[model samples]
Target: MAKLELIRNFCIIAHIDHGKSTLADRLLELTGTVAKRDLQEQLLDGMDLERERGITIKSHPVRMEYAAGDGNTYELNLIDTPGHVDFAYEVSRSLGACEGALLLIDATQGVQAQTVANVNLAFKQNLKVIPVINKIDLPAANLELCYEQMEEVLALPREEALCVSGKTGEGVKELLEAVVSRIPHPELLDIPGTAALIFDSNYDTYRGVVNYVRVKNGTFRRGTRIRLFNNGIESEVKEVGFFSPEMRAADELTAGSVGYLLPNLKSPSDTKMGDTITDVKDPCPEPLPGFKEVRPMVFSGIYPIDTADYEQLKASMGKLQLNDAAFLYQAETSAALGFGFRCGFLGLLHMEIIQERLRREYNCDIIATYPSVIYNVYMKSGEMIPVDNPVFLPDPSGIERIEEPIINCHIMIPSEYIGDVMNLVMSKRGICTNTVSVDARHVIITAEIPMHEILIDFHDKLKSMTRGYGSMDYEPAGYRADKLVKLDILVNGEPVDAFSSIVHTDMAYGRGRQLAERLKDVIPPQMFQIAIQAAVGGKVIARESIRAMRKDVLAKCYGGDITRKRKLLEKQKEGKKRMKQIGQVNIPQEAFVAVLKATETNS
Candidate 1:
C-alpha cells in the first residue's frame, strides 16, 4: 500500500484551449509516465473522441514520480478535468476526488466564464487553488494582466502565481516546483473500515463497468464483501485494482489512492459515480453525504430508422447506460411513432454522444425527437407530476399550474458584440441580471432564463455574436411559472408527438420559422407534396412544403449502365423503406436531424 505522506492529489482547471491538456502531457513526460521518444500528442487524453474534439470529456487520474529541488522523489496524482459547462456534473465528481486544483489562466485571454465557475466550485469543495498562468510564449501573452485577473478574481497573491508555457517548457520547472511545494499532500483518512467514493466509470466492451474511485477512509482487498450505497448492491470485490491507463490488479488499495473496483455489479446504476463503496462487514453511516442521485436534465424520444433495428437499439442503450449513469431510459409508446425510448441526458452533448454511439458502435441507425425540458405540473386536486415529454403532458385545463426549470447563465464576450448579444438574449426571454467589464476589451454578462429557451442554441448565439470569441457557462437555478405552450409539428395534418415541445411564447415564432425551414431540408420529396407545419395549441405559426422529386432517375441508360441504374433504384427503395410513411410523405434520418438542429442555428 502507498503511504499517506507520499501521495499528492490535485486537479487541473482552466478555460477551453488554455493548454490544460498540453500542460498535463508535459507533466507526464517530465515525470516519465511516457518516454521522450515514444510520446504521442496529448497522451493524458486517451479517448479518441476527446482528442478529436479537443476537450477532455472525463477526468484522467495519472500517477507520476517527480524529483523536487530538495532532491526527493515524490508521487503525484494529477487529475485532468473537463473544462466545458456541459460536463459540469462530471467535473464536480472529479473535483471531489482531489485535495487541490491547479487553476490555469491563458495569458492572452486572462480569465473566462468557466474559469470563475471552476474556481468557485473548487472553493466550495474546499480544495486548495494553485494559480498558474499558461502560454507565456505567445507574443500577445500578457502575464501582468493575467496575474491581476487571478489576484482580483481568485484572490491569489502575485508572489504565489507561477508563469509557464507547456508548449516550449518555459518556466515549467518553477510551475512543477510550485505544484510540489504549494499543493498540500493528501492526509489519507486511516479509519478502521473500507470506504471509497466512486468518482466516475466507463464500460469496457470486455471488462464491463470500469469504476474509478478514491479511497476516502480505509482499505479494501480482493474478494472483500462491499456494498454500494447508491443502489443497495452487495457484491464480492471480483477485482480490486488501479488504473495505469488500463486496469491492473492490486491485492489491496489503501486510503488516499485512486483506483477501480469491478464489483461485477452488472448495472452502472449499482456503482453510481458518487456512491460510497463501504465494507459490508462494517458499513459506514446509512448513506454517503455527497451522494445525490443524478437526474437527466433533457429528455427526448429515440426510434430506430429501420423498425427492424428496434431490438438492437434497446440492447445498445442497456449496455451503454451500464457505464453512463447519467443516461435515463424508460419504454415509451407514442400513438404516431410506435414504441421507442424516452431517453434522458445531462445536456445536449450527452444526448448527442449516446445517439452518435448508437449508430457508430452498435451499427444501428436511429431517429430522435427534439430535446425537451422536464416540467412539473400541479393539477386542480394538488397532485404533482413530472412531465418529460409534451406528448404525455395533460391538457391546459387539467393543469392547474405548470412551471419549468430556470437556469442562471453567464456569457463572456468581447466588448464589441454587446448590443447584438443583448438583443439576442432579450428575444430568448432572458432577463439580463448583471453585466460587468472583466477587462477593458471583454464583458461578463449574466442572465436568468428558462432552461428550455437556451438549451438549443444559446451557445451558438453567443459564439456568433462575438465572432466565435465568447464563452458561456450555466447551471440550473430553479423552476418558475411562465407563459409556456406546447408547439407540435404536424405532417399531413397528423401531429407527431415525438416532434412536440413546450416552449415560451417569446421564442415560439422565431423557433417555429427556423424549424419549418429545416424540415424542408430534411424531409425527402415523395410522390406527393409534403406539408410541414409548426403549430402552437391548434394554431399554425409557420409552414413549409417539400415538393415531390420531378426527375429522380436516369431516363435512358446504355448497355452496362442499365445494371448500375437498376442498383441505384434498389438503393433508393431500401432508403425509402427505412423512412417512416406519413400519409404520402417519407421521413428519413436527415429530416429528424433537421428538426433537431433547426434551433441549433440561433443567430
Candidate 2:
C-alpha cells in the first residue's frame, strides 16, 4: 500500500462556466496522469450532453501523480463536481469523499452567489479550502477586485489566495504544490471490519451497478464480500479499480483511497449514495455521520405524446434511473395526454435535463407539464397529504390551510442593475431579507420566496434583468402558510387533468387568462366552435374560444318565409347538439408545453 502521508484527496468547486473543467484538464496534463497528446477540453466531463452544454452533469474522480518541490512524489485524487445549484447534492457528496477542496472563483466575475455558497459548504465540512482565482489571462479580469471580494465576501485571506489562468499554463504548478503541502491526508482508521463511503454510483449492463467509494477503514479487494450498511444487501466484490483517468484494475483499494468497485449488485435500488459499505462477515458498528438522503425539490408530469409509447417510456425511465438514483418517478395517467410518468427532480435544471435526456437518449416524444413543488395539505378529516403531482391536489373543502415550500435565495448582481433585479424578484412573491454591496459595482441580495415561483423561469429572468452579470443560489427553507388554489383548464367543456396546477390565489386569475389565450392559439379550429376555460374549483376565471370553420350555406337562399327560416334554425340546433357530442378538439402537443411559458410571471 502507498504511504498515507503521500496521499492527498480533494475536489474542485466553482460556479457554472467558471472554467472548473478546464482547470481539471490542465491539472491532468501537468501531473502526467494522462498523456499530453490525449488531453482535450472537458476531458473529465464524460456525458455527451455535458460537453455540448459546456457543463459537468456528473462528478468525475481521477487520481494523479505529482512530484512536489520537496522532491517527494505524491498521489492526488481530485473529484471534479458540477457547479450548478441543481447539482449541489453532487457537490456535497463529492466533498464527503475528500479531505480538502479547491475553492475557485472567476477573476472576471469575482465571488458571485454560488462562489460564497461553495466556500460556506467547505467551512461546514471542515475541509481545507485552498482559495484560487481563475481566468487571470483575460483582459477584463479584475484580480484586485477578486481579492477584495474574497476578503470581504468569502472572508478568505487575500494575500494567500493563488491566482491562476486555466487558458494558459500560469500559476498551476504553484497551485499543485499548495494542494500537497496545505491539504492534509485522510486520517483513516485501521479496524477489523471494512468501511467505505459510496459518494456516487452508476450502472453498466455487464457489471450491474458500479459504485465509486472512498475507503475510510480496512480494504476493499476483489472476492471480498461487501454489504451496504443501511440496506444490509450483500454481494461478492467482482472487481476493484482506480481511475487511471480510465478504469484500470487495481488489486485492492486500501484505507483512505477512492476508487470504483463492482460487487455483483443486482439493481440500482440495492445501493445508495452516502451509504456505508462494509465487509459482510464483519460489519462496522456504526455508519458515517450526517448522511442526508437526496430529496427531490421540483416535480413535473412527463406524458408520452402517443399512448402506445407508455411501456417504452417506462423502460427508458427505469434504465435512466439505474444510472441516476436521485431521479424519482412513478407511473401516472392523464386524461388529456394519456399514460405518462410523474417525475421528481432536484431542481428545475435537473427536471429539464431529465426531460431532454428522455427525448434525445430514448427517442421518446413527450410533453412535460408545468413544474411544481411539493406541498403539505392538512385536511379536516385529519389526513395530511404530500402533493408532488398536480393531479392529486386535495379538495379545497378538506384542506385546513394550504402550505407551500419556501426557499432562501441568494442573488448577486452588478450594482447598476440592483433596482431591476430587486423589482423582478419582489414581483414573484419575494421578501427581501437583506441587501449588501459586495464591491463598488457588485451587490448581493437575500430573499425568501416560494420555491414554486423559482421553478418557472426565475433564473432565466434573473439573467435577463441583470444583463447576464448576475448569479444565484438557493436552498429549501421549510414550509409556510400561503393562499394557494388549484386552477383547472377545460377544453370543449372536458376538464384536462394534465393542465391543472395549484397556484397562489392572487395570481391565479392572471395565470388562468394567459393559459386560456395561449391554448386558444394552439387548439386548431374544428367544424364546430370549441370553448376553452380556466376555473378555480367551480368558478370560471377566464375564457377563450376557437371559432368554428365557416361555410356559405346561406349563399343559396336569397329570401325565405318564416317556415323556411324555422326549418333552417331547427337544422342548425340539431347540428350543434351532434357536434357537442362527437367533436374532438385537435389540441396541439405544443399547447401543453405553452402553458408553462404562459405561467412565467417573472417579468
Candidate 3:
C-alpha cells in the first residue's frame, strides 16, 4: 500500500454523453488496473439497462496504482459519477468521497447545463477541479471553442484546459500525470479517532451489504467493532477489502485510502449512503458532514397486472428497497385497481428505472398510475399533512391551503432555439430569472417552474423544440401556495380513485376534458351508455359518453304484430336496466395507465 502522502483520491464529473464513462475506461487502462481485453465500453456501468440506455445510473468507485513522473507510485482512487441532473444527489455523494474532480467537457458540444451545475457543486465542496476537453478526435471537435466556454461559463482556466480523445487515447498519458501533479493529496488528519465517509454501497445475496468508503482519519480492518455514527449502529467488521474494479482483500485501509467494509450487513438500508463510519473503541468526536436527506419528490401507485403477481411484486420491491433506500413504498388499495404499493421516487428517471428493473430483473408485469408530486395540506383544524397519493387528499372544504413544490431549472441550449424553448417553458408556468451567453452560439437560461410541471414530458419537449440541442438541470426552489385541485374521474357516476390526480386550477378543465376523452376511447362500451366525468370537489369540469352496444329489437319482428314489438321493447328495456344496475364497468388494465402511455408517446 502507498503511504498517506502518496495517495490521490478523485472523481470524473461531466454532463450526459460527455464521455465520462469512456474517459474512466481510459484511466483504468492507463493504470493497467484491468487488462485491455477485459474492458468493454462503459465497463463501470454494471447494469444492462445502463448500457441499453447509454447512461450511467449509478456511481462506481475503483482504486488504481499510477507511477507519476515524480518517480513515485501513487494510490489513485477514482469515483465515477452519473451525468444527469436526476442523479445529482448520487453525484454529490461521489464527489464527497474525493479530494479532486476531473471536469470533462465535450470538445464539440462544449459546456452544458449539468456541466455548469456539477462544476459549481465541486467548487462548493472545495474539490480541486481539472478541466479536460474530450472527444478532440471527432471531425467537429473545436478545442479552442470548448476552452472559451469552459473559461466563460465555468470560470475555469482557458489555457490550462487539456484536450484529449477518450476514444483514441490521445493525450491520456499526460492527463494521468496531470491528475497526480495537480490534484492534491488527501489531507492527513491525525485526530485521535477513526473516521470514514460511506458514500455508496451495494447488496449481494451471498456476502451481504458491502459499503464503499473513503478513509478520512484512521485505519479500518476486519474483526473489529465499528459503528455508523448517524444511527449509532455498531457491529464487528466481518471483512475489509478494496476495489481495483473488482474486490481484492486488503489487510487494512487507513486515512486517505478508498476501500470497502463489510459488517455482515444483511439489509442495504443498514449501510446508508453518507453515513460516517468510525472505530467502535475510539469513535470520532463527531461525524463527518451529514449528507442532505433526499426525499422522494414524485410518487405513483404500482399494481400487478395479474392479481396473483401481487405477492411477487411485493417481494421484488422488498428486495429492491433493500438495494435502493431512496425507493419508498407502502401498501395502498385502489377501488378501481385493487391492492398495490404506492411508491415515491426522487424523479421521473428514478421512477422509470425502478419500474423497468421490476419488469426486467424480477420478471414482473405491472401497471403504474399517473405520477404526482407531494403536496402539503393545511386542514380546517390547523393540522398540516403531506399527501403524496391523491387518495389521501382531504376534501377542499376541510383543507385551508395546498402547497406545491417548485424548482429552479437551468437550461442550456444553442442561441437560435432560445425563443421556442423559452415559450415552451413559459407555457408550463415558468418564470425566467436569469440568462447568460457563454458565447455567441450557446446560452444558459435559468427559470423557476413547478416541480410537477417537469414531471412528465418537459425534457422531451425541450429537446424537441431545440432540435435535440438543449439540456436541463434543476434544483428544488422550495414550495409555495398554489391554486391546486384534485381532479377525479368518474365512470357512470362511480369515481375511480386510481385515475384521480392533483392539477392546477387553471388547467383542470382542459386536462380533465383530455383525460375523459382518452378514457372514452379506451373503455369498451357497456350495454348502456357509459358516462365519463372529470370532476373537482363534486363539480364536473368535463364529460364524455361511450355509446352503448345497440341492437335492432324490431329487425327480427318484421312480420310480427305491433303487440309483439312492444313486448320485446319492454323486455329489452328491463335487460338494459338490469345490466346498468348489476353490471360493473370492466376497465381494462390499459385504461388504468392510459395517461402514462400518452406521456410516454409524447416524450
Candidate 4:
C-alpha cells in the first residue's frame, strides 16, 4: 500500500470549452499513465455525444504516478469534471472524493459565470483550490485581466495563480509539481472498518454494475464481503482495480485511493452513487454524509416511436438512471402517445443529451415532449399539489393560486452587449436585480426569472445577443405565486394531453398561437378538416385548420346540366360534413418532434 502522505486527490474544474479535458490529457502524458504514442485529445471524454459537442458530460477519474522535484514519487488521483452549469451536480459529487481542485480559467475569457459558481461549490466542500489560467498560447490571451478578475470577482489571490497553456503543454510539468507541493494530501479518518464512498457507477453488460469509489479508510480486497451503508445490502467484492485511463486490475485498494470495485450484484438499481460501502461484518458506526438528493428542474415525456419497444425503453432508462443521478422518471400513459415515461432532468442540455444517448447507446428510438418545470398548485381548501404535467392540474375554480419555480441567474458578458442582453431578459419576464463591472470591458448581471421561461431558448438567445461572448449559471430560488394557466391543444375537438402545457397568463395567447401554427404545418391533412385549437379553461385562445383533401365529384358530369354538377357537389359536401363529425385524427410521431424542435428555438 502507498503511504498516505504521498497521495494527492484533485480534480480539474472550469467552464465549458475552457480546456478541462485537454489539460487532463497533458497530465496523463506527463505522468506516463498512458504512453505518448497512445495519447489522444479528450481521452477522458468517453461518450460520442461529448466528443461531438466538444464538452464533458460525466466526471472521469484516473490514478497516476508522478515523480516530483522533491525526489519522492507521488500517487495522484485526478477526477476530470464537467464544466457546464447543467452538470454542476456531477462536479459537486466529484469534489467530495478529492481534497483539492484545479480552478482553470481561460486567458482570453478570464472570469465566467460558471467559473465563479464552481469556486463556490469547492469552498462549500472545504477543498483546497489551485487557480490555473489556461489557453495562454492564444493570440488574444490577456494575463493581467485574468489576474484582476480573479482578485476582484473570485476573491482568489493573484500571486497563487499559475499561467499554463493546456494545448501546447507549456508549464504543465511545473503545474504537476505544484500539485504535489501545494495541494494537501488526503486525510484519512480513524475508522474501524472499511468505508469507501461511491462517487460514480456504470453498468457493464458482462460484469453487472461497476462502482467507482474513493477509499476513506481500511482496505477493500477481491474476496471481501461488503455492505452498502445506505441500505445495508450485503454483497461479495468480485474484483478491485484502478483506472490507468482504463481499467487495470489491482490486488487491493488501500486508504485514500480512488478506484473501481465490482460487487456481486445483478441490477444497476442495486447500487447508488454517493452510497457508503463498508465491510459487512465490521462496518463503520455512522454512514458517510452522502450527497443531497438532486432535484430535477425540467420535466418532459419520452415515448418509444414503436410501441413494441416499450420494455426495451424502460430497461434503457434504468441503465441511464444508474449512470446519471440527476435524471428521474416514472411510467406515464398518454392518450395521444400511448405507454411512455415522464423524465425529469437538470436542464435542456442535459435532457437533450439523455435523449441522444437513448438513441445512440441503447438503440431506442424515442420522442420527447415539450419541456416544463414543476409548479405548486394551491386549492381553495389549502391543499397544495405539485404538478409537473399540465394534465394533472386541477379545475380553475378549485385552484386558489399557482406558484412557479424561480431561479437566480448570473450572466457574464461583454460591456457593449449589456443593452441587448437586458432587453432579451426583460422580454422573457425576467427582472435584472443587479449589475457589477468586472473590468472595463466586461460586466456581470444578476437576474430573477421563472425556471420555465429559461427551460427552452433563453441560453441560446443570450449567446446570440452577446455574439457568443456570454455565459450563464443559475440555481433554484424557490417558488412564487403567479397567474399561471394550463393551455390544452384540441385537434378535431378532442384535447390531446401530450400537447398541453402550463404557461403564464400573459403569454398564453402568443404561445398558443405559435404552437397551433407550427402544428398545422406538421399534422397531415385528413379526409375531413381538422381544427387545431389552443384553449385555456375551455376558452379557445388560438385556432388553425387543415383543409380536407378534396375529391373530384364532377368527373362523371361532363357535358351535363349545371344543376347536375351542383347536385353532385352538394352530395359530396354532405358526405364530407358527416365524415368530419365521426373521423379521428391520427397525429404522427413527426408532428411531436417538429413541434419540440420549434419550441426549443422560438419559445
Candidate 5:
C-alpha cells in the first residue's frame, strides 16, 4: 500500500446546482473509480428524490486511485456534501469530517450567499479552502469577475481560484493538482485513545445501527467493545469497513480515514448524528462535541384519509425515522381525525420532503394541515406547555407569556427586483439588516424574519417578485418574546385540531382570512353546507361558506338507460356505503385527495 503522505482527504462544497456533484462524478471517472462505459449521472446522490431534484441530500464518500506526476498512484478520498440550507446540520457534520474543502463558484453568477456561507464554515473548522470557478466552458463565463468576487468576499488570492468546467473537464487536471498542493496532509495522531465523530448514521435490519465516522485518533478492530460518550451506551463492534463506492468494502481503516461500524445497536434512537465512538481500552478525556439538538420551527398534523389506514400511517413513520432522525412526532388524538402524529420539521423544505417520502416510499395517502409554529401557553397554575395544535390551546384568560423563533435570512436577486422584494419582506414582518452588491447584476439582501411568516408559498412569491432571478437562504437566530395567538378552524360548528395553526397576533387577521379562503376551495360542496371559519377565542375574524350542491342527478347507469329510479338509487346506496362519514357529510377517497392537494396549494 502507498504511504499516508501521498493520500489526499477533502470534500466538495457548493451552492445548489453549482456543479459540485458533476465535478465529483468526473473526478471518479478520471481516476478509474468508475468505469467509462458504466457511468451514471450524479453517482453520489443515491436517494431517488435527490437524483430527481438534481440535489444531494446525503454526504457520500468515495475512494479512488489517481496517478500523480511522479508516476506513482495515490489514494484520494472525496466527500460530497448537500448544498441546501435546510440540511445545514448535515453540511456542518460533513465539514467536520474532512481536512480540506473545494469551494465551487459559478463563473457567471460570481460569489453567491450560499458560497460565502460554505467558505465561512470551512474557515471556522480550520480546513484548507480551495476556490474553483466552475462552468468556465460556457460561452458567457467570466473568470475575472468570479476571481475578483472571491477575493473581495472570501479574502482568497486571485491565483488560488482555479477555472474549470465540470462538463467539458477543462482545467480539471490543474484543479486536481491544486488540491494536492493547497490541501494539507492528514496528521498521524499519536494518542493511545480511540475516538471518532459520528458524522452520519443509518439503521440496517441485520447489522442494527450502522454509523459513519472519521477516526480522529487511535484504531479499532472487529469485536472491540466500545461505548458512546454522549449517551453512555455500550456495544460490541460487529464489523469495521470503509466505503469502496464500487459495491464492496475495505478491510480496515485508521485515524484520518472514514469508515463504517456495525455496533449491533438495535434501535436507531440509540445513535444520533454528531455522536462519538470511543475506545474500549482508553476512551477520550472529553466526548466529541455533543449533538446540537434542533427544535422544529414548523408544526403540522398528519392523518390518513381513511381512518382504517391509521395503523399503516404510524408504521410508515416508524420506518422513516430509522433513516431520518430529524422528524419529531407526538402521539396526538384529534376529535375529527382520530389517532395520528403531530409532526414537526426544521423548515418548509424539510416538511415537504418528509411528506413526499411518506407517500412515495410507503404508498399511503395522507392529509397534512397547513404548516404553522408552536405556541406557548401558561395557565392559572403557572404551568407552561408548548402547544402545536390550536385546539389544545388554553383560553385567553389564563395566558401569561409567549415566544417565537427568529431567523437570519439572505436573499440574492437581480438589481431590478430590489424594490418589490423589500416591500414583500416588510409586509411579512421582516426587517432588513443590510444589502451588498454581489456584482453589477445581483444584490445580496439580508433580513430577519419570523419563521412562520415564510412557511406558506414564500419561495414561489419570491420567484414571482424577482422574475425567477432570485435565491435565498435562512438560519435560525435564537428566539424573541412575542404575543402569539392560536387560530382555530371550525368545520360545521366543530373545531378540528388538525386544521388549527399558531400565529403572531399582528398576522392573525391576514393569516386567518387566507386560510379560510383556502379551505373554501378545498372542502367540496356536499349534501350539507360546511362552514370554514378562523376563530380567535370566541370571536371569528374570517369566515367562508362552502355552499351545498344545488343540483343532484344520476348521470348514467352501468347498463342501458334505466327508466326505473330504484335501480339508480341502489347503485348510489352502494357508493355511499363505501364513503366515509365525517360529521354530517359523506365523502369519497377522490374528494379526500382533492382536499389534501388544496390544503397544500396556496390560494
Candidate 6:
C-alpha cells in the first residue's frame, strides 16, 4: 500500500467537449499507467456509446504513480467526470471522493454556462479548485480573453491559471507537478473500524456487483466480512484491487486510497451507490456523509418489443440501475404497451442514453413512450397526487388544479442572437427574468421555463439560433399552478395510452393536430378507413383519416351491364363495413418510432 501522506485525490471538471477525457489520456501516458502501444484516445471512456458520440457518460477513476521533481514517488487518484448537465449527478458523486478539482476551461471557448455551473458545484463541496486552461494549441485560442473571463465571470484568480494543450501534451508535466504540490493530501481519520464510501459501481455477469470505493479510516483486505450500512447486507470480500484504468488485484487497500471491492452481493440493489461499507465485526461508530438522493425530472415508459422478453428486460434494467444512480424505474402495465417499467430520468438526454444502452449493451429490443414531467394533481376531495404518466391522471371533473414543474435555465450565447433566442423562449411560454453581459461578445440569459416545454428540442434550437456557440445549464425552480390538461390520442376510436400526454391548455390544439397528422403518415392503411383523433376531456380537438386501399373488382366485367358493376361495388362496400366492425388496427413498431421523433421535433 502507498503512504497516505504522499497521495493526492483530484478530479477534472469542465463543460462538455472541453478536453476532460483527452487530458486524462495525457495524464495516463505521462504517469506510465498504460503501455504506449496500448494507449488510445479517451482511454477512460470505455463505453462504445461514449466513444462514438465523443462524450463521457460516466465518471472513471484510476490510480497513477508519478515520480515528482521533489524526489519522491506520489500516488495520484484521479477521477474523470462527465461534463453535461444531465450527468451533473455523476460529477457530484465524483467530487465526494476527491480533495481537489482541476477546473478545465477551453482557451477557444472561455467561461461557458456549464463551466460556471461546475465551478459552483466544486465550491459547494469545499474542494480545492485549480484552474487549468486547455486546448491552447488550437489556432482560435485566445489566452487573454480566457484569463479575463476567468477573473470576471468565474471570479477565479488569473495568476493561478495554468495553460496546457491536452492534444499535444504541452505543459502537462508542470500541470502534474502542480497537482502534487498544490492539492492537499486526504485527511486520515483516526476512527478505528474499517469504512469505505462507495462512489460508483457496475455489474459483471461473472463477478456480480463491482463497487468502486474510497477507503476512509481503516484497511480492507480479502476475506473480510463487510456490511453495507444503508442496506445491512453482509458479504465476504472476495477481492480487493486498484484500477490502473483496468482492475489489477492488490493485497489490500489502505487508508486514504481509492480502489475496488468485490463482495459476495446477492443482487445489484443490495450495493447502493453512496452507501458505507464497514467491517461487520468492528463497525465504524457512524457512517460517513453520503451523497444526496438524485431525483429524476423526466419520466417515460419502456416496453419490450416482444412480450416474451419481459423477464430479460427486467434483468437488464436491474443491471443498468447498478451502473446509473440517476435512473429510476417501477413496474407498470399499459393497455396498449402491455407490461413495462415507468422509468424516470434527469433529462431527455439521460432518458435517450439509457434506452440506447438497453438496446446495445443488453441486446434488448425496447420501445420508449413519449417523455413527460412529474405533475402535481390536486383533487377536489382535498387529495394531491404526483402524476408522471398520463394514464395515472385522475378524471377531469374530480381534479381541482394541476401544477407543472418549472426550471431556472441559464443560457450563454453570442450577443447578436439574443433577440432570436428571447423570441423562441417566449414562444415556448417561458419568461426571461434577467440578462447579464459576461464579456463584450457573450450574454447570459436567465429564464423560467416549464420543464415539459424544454424537454425535447430546446437545446437543439438554442444551438441552431446561436450558430453552435451557445451553452445551457438548468435547475429545478419548483412547481407552479398551470392550466394543464391531459391529451389523449385515439386510433379508430380506441385510446392509445402510449401516445397520451399532459400538455398546457393553450398548446393542446396545435400539438394534438401535429401528432394526429404525423400518425396518419405512419399507420398503414387497412381494408377499412382508420380515423386518428386527438381528444381532451372526451372532446375531439384534431382528426385525420387514412383512406382504405381499394381493390380493382371491376377489371373482370370490362363492358358488362351497369347494374352488375353497381352490384359488385355495393358488395365490396358491405364487406368493408363488416371488416371495419371487427378489424383491429395493427399499429406497427415503426409507427411508434416515427411519432416519437415527430413529438420531439415539434415540441
Q: Which candidate achieves the best TM-score against the true structure?
A: 3
Question: What TM-score does candidate 3 reach?
Answer: 0.97
User: Which regions of candidate 6 fall more than 4 Å away from where they truly are?
Assistant: 190-193, 306-312, 549-583
TM-score of each prediction: 0.87, 0.96, 0.97, 0.94, 0.89, 0.93
Give all candidates' CA lDDT scores. 0.79, 0.87, 0.88, 0.91, 0.79, 0.91
Across residues 43-86, which tens digit of lDDT does each residue of candidate 2 receive? 99987799999888899999998989999999899999989998
Ranking by TM-score: 3, 2, 4, 6, 5, 1
Tens-digit lDDT track of model 1 for 37-76? 8777777777677787787767878777788898778777
1-603 per-residue lDDT for model 3 (tens digits): 778779999999999989998988998998999998898999899999988998898888899898889899999999989898878888888888888999999988888899999999899899999999999999998887887897788888787788899998999999999888899988856566999998988888898988989989878888879988767788888888898898988999888899899886686777778989899887888878857677888998899988888999999999998778889999998888888999999898999999999999999999888889989998889999999888789878889899999999999999999888889888898899899897989989999999888988899888988888799999999998989999999998899898788898998898889889888889988889889999999899999999889898888888757899999999998898888888788898877777657845652
lDDT: worst 10-residue window of model 3: 594-603
Error of 6 at 87 (Å): 1.8
Clashes of 6: 0
* Position 108, candidate 1: lDDT: 87
- Per-residue lDDT of 1-603 in model 5, one digit per residue for the tens? 336677778999988889999999889877788888878889888879888988887788877778877677767778899898888888888888888999999887777767878888889889999889999888888888887778777899988778888988888888777777778877765555788989888877776888888877777778878998768999988788777674244555677777788887899988878887887777877766646765677888888878899999999899888888888887777666667788988778888889989999998888886676765566678898777666777777887776676889999888899999999889878899999987677788999988777878677899888876688888888667677887787777777665577777887888678767866776778754677788988989989998755334465434555665567677665554444244464334454456546656652
By the lDDT metric, which is better: model 2 or model 3? 3
